[model samples]
Target: MHKKAIYIMMLVAVLLASCSSPGRKALELSDNMLKTAPERALAILDSIENAGGLNREEQLHLVWNRAMAHQIMGMSLAEDEQLPEAIIHYREEADKQTDSYLLEASYLNWKGKRADAINVLNKGIGKIKDSTKRVKLMAEQARLLELQREYSKAAEVMERALELNPTKRDKAILNYKIGLNLSLAGDPRSEQFYSQSVRMATENGDTAMACEFLRNYADYLANNGKYRQSNNVYREISRMMPQMAGLSAIQMAMAGNYINLHMPDSARICNEKAIESEARLEAKGFDDISRRMVIELERCLLDYGDGKPVSYVGLSRYCDSITADMHAKESTLARRQEAKERLQWANHELRLDRQRMGWMLAAAVLLLLLGVAGGWIYYRNRLSRLAEAENSIDTLKRMLKETQTPAEETPEEKQQKSEDDAFFKKILLQQLGIIRMVASTPTNHNQALLKRIAGISEGKIQTDSLLVWPDLYLVIDRLYDNFHNRLTERYGNVLTEKEIQIACLLCAGFSTKEIGVVTQQSDATIYVRKTSIRKKTGAAEGQDIVSYINGIKAD
Candidate 1:
């Protein structure tokens, strides 16, 4: 039985090995497409992540390859005229990625954000321990500082990069950059560094790098009117790469130097040699488009220098191709801008949609609250009106019962009236106490109690006048029961809160001036309220509101 179980476990292990991990299939599919179709690979990777089948190792592979995909996307998408999105993707990829930082800094430098680009390089360098990468970052930072006109600081950075002991090829580039920086910093010794960089580039068989150093230094010399020295450097490059198509560039610069020095015959000879060298390089299978463009342009410049009519012949191919080159750069910039506008427009539309939804939601909430408030107000008013009507009917019945008696007053009626009056006053006191508590809050700034009381008095006249009038109505109903409904039913719905206050005070037999004092209203205000009540009751202008209110009967 034990041997059989061992055989069964071995079979299970073999089966497990035969099957793949959950995420492995998709990852393998993506890996196959990574080099040939990066965009499709990215989509596959994204789907795998969203569909959720990744193990721990698969997750790490996903992050590594996804970052690589984004880096490639930055290049291909930019070339495809999707630049803003491309740069954004590049920046996001660069954030945690050490290798991509240089690309991001280059973009920043092109944007004229030199300080920000340098800061990015500094942070990247701090994170990277690789000497080649550190040297590259430092050299770039030095170039940025030089562009900013901080020449000494630029030299300092370059000096630091040189201390990293880069390989021959990297040192050659860094040395050239440092020479440029030092030359611009007003150092005459920069020529030695330039010479060293050129010698090293030549020894390392990086003839192109050597040519770059020679060309830049020669151009600088020419610009400074050092024609003789610039001509020597050009001749040196011509000797180094005699059979290359690139010879046209050196001969052209040499011809320009000869022309500036008033050696027109020498310039003419160099121009002829440039035209001849072009045919040889073509025979040698040199297919550099930019170099050919420059060579043809120099051919044209040569004719102009020789005091001949500028030849339009043979310029069409290189001229139009160069024009396309110029347009390619311009279109790249325009596409970047177009991409930015598109993103901004999309974001703006999204924001507007969100704002519109928020306003709609707020309006919906407000309407719902208003509906609820309307129902509640109706319920409370209905209950109060009914209760006041029922109390008035009971009081009338009691009054009728007492009237039937000869002369004795009913104790129960007095007790009921007292209870009603007490209830009404209690509501008034409770409302006043709430007002006191609110007015006493820290929001009121804790002023003198007397001053606060005075402010409260003013508030009672302005706004709080309405709060008391409702309880006052209840008290009047308690005193005379159903008087409000009877008056309303007799008259129209013209009675307002102020009108009710006026009628109630008049029924209590208060003088107009005394009613004004009690209500915290001016005498003129009381008179106005009295007039309104009279109009509502349809009493004549000369009739007393108090007598009219007294004559109101429950029946």
Candidate 2:
């Protein structure tokens, strides 16, 4: 009875192996097309099509594989600039005996039948039960709409694609496409869409896409007369992709736009930056684009600043020609056709080889299953070993953690940290008070207060020793002198130097503790001086001490 059961099991396994379809073989052929080995791919696909005793599933797979081979060949021809010939092969594959709506849609889309492309995609979406495949079809349709310049419709379709479950990469692309459509539509809400795309790209860690978003945002800002903001955005672009050759040209263009907005200083700064970048590129022998950009920028600067108009006849013409030549040599499809064909052919051969090997893999898998069945008792032994290893790891980890010691903080260390924190807090409060005081005063008072604040913030202050109080006193005296000079310039004959110092202390809006820390004076003395200064400055009712000081301005 045991022998009979073994024989029956072996027979069932053999029958199942025989029933396996040629799908993997077809996939291998399809992969060859990607490697530009179209002839080899076609040969493998033809062998599959001619293989005898194939069931319906195997026949369908073979047809699909053959279609892929043709599609790859068409791509190769397109790369060779034989567009019409490529289209012919693409059409042939589209009409092949296959149920792959994706392949059909792709071919139709490339053939410029936009409506037919969308129709084929819709059919695929309806017929495909897999959520992943359905979303892919929707994305393709949305891309087609975008290419047709139907931006609103494209955005709506992309929204639907986003509704479907997508990988992070797909979501990023979807957001970018939506932003692009919104921008093309010229809607004010495009900024929000672009921002969303930027966030998505940043999350995905796609530096190139992030740079592109920054460039577009900068252009938008410049067009809207936000020159300073646009310059900031361009700076971000330069920081992100310093080696990008086009940035020099972009910076120069932005500088010219700044000049148009009457920001000559900013324009000069941008122009200088572009010239520096171009010089660096020239030094590295990557100066083709950079050199041209420098010339154009120099011309623009002269035109805007020195009354010399830019001439586009000689240098511009040459620059455009060079750009065209470089583009043709790079990622252009026409230059890569031969490689594409070879890849297709290799993929097709690999498919047939895999199909033959599939039976061997099945036999190995069956042997593995038998080993697993016989080793059930040994499985427990393996688990015991794993458990022992894990326990050992846990013991080592605990020991490591216990052996580690955190450094102890000294008294001076703790005190320094506290002082640093307090210093930053004081700075923050002082800044807020200055802004509020300046905003609340009259125009003349506002100018005087701004000048005083600028003086205080201009240079670094030295605080070397807490024991040497004279250094601290010197810093305070210097700050007071600056305040007095600015205040005297704006408000003449209103307050004496002593009163000005007292008024400045009041206008700072400091608490008693802060005032003592800043001025090296007692809180009671500060209060007494403030009262005396207020009386001397003005005797009006309902006037705050800070307001009274700001109220003194020369006509």
Candidate 3:
């Protein structure tokens, strides 16, 4: 028996030593990798991989680390514009392991053969059973689909990914991707989907994703004439991604929506940002679509700044200059000319009125008399309605105040209430016993117990003032009874209510003032109560209140 026990102890020690060995090595490697040369890190990983007699887990870890190093190397090459070399390294890393198919897909996609990359991913998805891995692959596939302008298909892929992994982290990314696809699709139903995605992303703690979704959602809402919601979403996006290029231009486009919603000040701010973002985009050599968007945003800013309704002629000129679509630009210009001609014809008709002075003078005198009579009658009716409403509101207010007051109870009634309270306390204790039997387990029912106690206490005390007393012994008794019973059931013995309260107060590491606020007692009184409770409970010296509470169980 002694030899067997010694062998077991030795085995346990060996296992613990082995566990400690890898953790320290991993930490050391991680710390060195942060400051060490990349080539050196790669060499170390390569040595580990080639080291004979290593276990399968160790070999896999080495392979994973080397792959990460290669990926970082490829990214640096790409950033330096060495695409061919970057592609070679990325492809080599991807080809090293069958488990890392997503990396391979990314490499192929970036190499400009998107279809081939997606097919590779499809094969891997069929083989992988892990839902998390599958979800990640699907999201990557959706991103590729978005780049290809297959918006509907991309949305479908994102939805499938979300269905596979309903965790908040996954949901946030999925919703943002879906919103992006819908925004590109330009369908009215896209607005609804984008809004839902923005809300989900925000709830899931993905602020960056939420910001991206809100930006797209705002654009969709503005286009659909939901200006108020669109403007609000734009403001949120601006606040989140203040440094994002083209943000000001996007906000400028949204300014028109804000103005239409009767928010000129907000519109002006949006317009200013739009102009600034556009200037930044120009400096950065933005694409033709982005340039055209900036020009339109600038026109909008100018129109709003000048306090004029955006003129069709000015809009047409602006659109013609920047729009890439020849046919659309021509059509807009033609419409503007037609509108201008119509306005001139109306103005010309008004000019003819200058020759007919005698008839115009008589008509103006009669119109003035009619206006004066109508204004007087309208003002009198409005005043009468206002007076009636005021009187009705005053009567309702008085009735409400009367209903809020409590009825006064006599001395005999007070004595009867006192007798009733004692009877209810007995009934409450019996009910508590019933609850304990029903619960039959340690559970988080403290709030439920409090509710039951409050009901019982209310039955005893008829007056609100009595019920809300600072030193309500009945409430404390009920609270203690519930906690003590649960603790006893769990542990066979536990601290009394006063002891638990005192220990919790002390253990909470709170000041006397804080304890007073929590317990609704004065600081001096709380200190006194804590002292008495601690002495009765016999808590160990220097033990924390939280630790003591944690130890107790109502078994």
Candidate 4:
């Protein structure tokens, strides 16, 4: 009887293995097309008659490909009904591979369906049994919450992930993520997690990751106004990665820390080293011209700090050039991203044509012709816009060069320029305060404050009866050769009234603190408003907002 039972079990095992082979092969074929031709990949996945024959891992792979296909095709999760089959398979093995759910949720979040993404992950977390898998889902959930700016809730989710006792590497990464969210949430306990992450990563022999964690720790310290400690961390990183490619970044950060610490000599030395390293990197084909401009600006700051003569026009040119480079890079990046999306959609349509060629040949031909026409029109419009932008940039650059230190200026011109420079300096100082505010606290209060600032800037709310926005506008127009009217005419539609107000403030010599006091709000509120202004203006990171605003030439 025992011999007969063994024979029967062996025969059943052979049958199960044979049945799974076709499903595995189908999965492999679909996987290859997931990236470039995901619509076809989905069709192949749909053709699989029995996913039940595949194991948990294979089932998860199928679902992952399916989810990715739906994402690439810009289809909602609800459109792909097969995505949930993997979750329904083998309830006992549910914890084995849950990454599909995470990927699906990520796609949903990217589509601005953040609430749906959270719900999907919550469902997965409830279904998952094992600690490791559950933590993976929870970690992703925490990440999504972070994007929603619910930093406190993100920290809580991360804490729950930690309670599950993840693997060593996972624990290290989780600790860093938790610290990041906690820090963003303005919780002091973030320091503990940051330290723990560094220690854990170092002990795990992941020195690179440890250094990365240490960098974040240093940034957090610097952000919280602990310059000395932040520099210490930077020094430690310097020791760890002495010959690293990113040495210039570390040195530049150290220079800023030293400046904050009121040590100009040390700051200058660090700045010089940063410039040297940057030059070396540039020689090695690093195309980040903006960083070099930033270093030059820092040098100007150092010179000014030492009571040396600093050419204001030269500084203005540098600011304008940096802002231009930033705008170009941003435009290129945006176009490239859109191009990729269009390519994916094109591939999706091609696959649909092939599948329906026999029945809808005439319709497919008509749609193809329309698509080509539309694409051509879009391409032409894009080129025209790009040409116009380039022309505008060229005109601005020519204006700056032409305006540079004319040989003989009238007394009125010199006084006006000097006043402009002074106002620019005031705006620069105010912007520094605004940047600091952005770094410190990013909360709901800041959001409300942004709206309030916008209201005041747009003239919806009057802070000063004597100098309402329109009155201030006229003052700016009279002072700067109708700069207010010209700026409005040029960027009136692109910039909100609030942004126009801030720009006027930049030109009018209003300090950030003065704005804050007048608005009856904190500097943090103004920071949020200033950040929005920067985005709308497309100003480069670390570039002078005042310079960018004032450098605009009416077309």
Measured over all alpha carbons after superposition, the RMSD of each candidate to the real structure, in angstroms, is 23.2, 44.9, 38.3, 46.6
Candidate of highest lDDT: 4
Instruction: List TM-scores for all candidates, in order.
Output: 0.42, 0.41, 0.37, 0.47
Best candidate (score: TM-score): 4
- lDDT per residue (tens digit) for residues 1-555 in model 4: 245445544664565467567678888999789888998999898766556557778877787678777766767666545555654453334433476677668666766889999998998899778788889789889978888899999989988888899999999999999899889989999999999999999999998999999999999999999999999998888787776534677878888898888899999998999888887886797736566666777777898999998766754765687689889999999999999889767777775665466336545644565566567667877786555444433432232233343434558877676667444433332332332333464665576434443444334555554235675576668667787887777678888876787777666655665555445345687777788777877888667776776677722
Q: How many times do residue backbones clash in model 2?
A: 21
After superposition, the stretches of candidate 4 with alpha carbons farther than 4 Å from their true spots are: 1-27, 30-66, 69-97, 283-297, 311-555
Q: lDDT-based ranking, best first? A: 4, 1, 2, 3
Across 1-555, the per-residue lDDT of candidate 1 in tens digits comes to 245445544665554443335357767888788768889988777654222234455565665555556555664222222333333444444343554566566556666677888998998888787787788778778877877899878878877887889888877887787778777777876777888889889999988889889988888788778999998888777677775434666776777788779787887777677667666766797645655555566556666766778765676765676589789989999999999889767766776686578557656755665566666667877786555444433432333234333433559876665455444434443454423544456645534433433343344324364356655666666576666656656664678766666676565545565344345566678777777777777778979765665576623
Q: Which whole-number lDDT from 0 to 100 does residue 513 have in model 2?
A: 43
Cα deviation at 299, candidate 3, in Å, is 5.2
Which model is ahead, 3 or 4, in terms of lDDT? 4
Model 3 segments more than 4 A misplaced: 1-99, 206-208, 235-250, 256-269, 273-555
Model 1 per-residue lDDT at 363: 63
Task: Please state the error at residue 194 of candidate 3 in Å.
Answer: 2.2
| Worst lDDT 10-window in candidate 2 | 458-467
lDDT of 2 at 380: 70
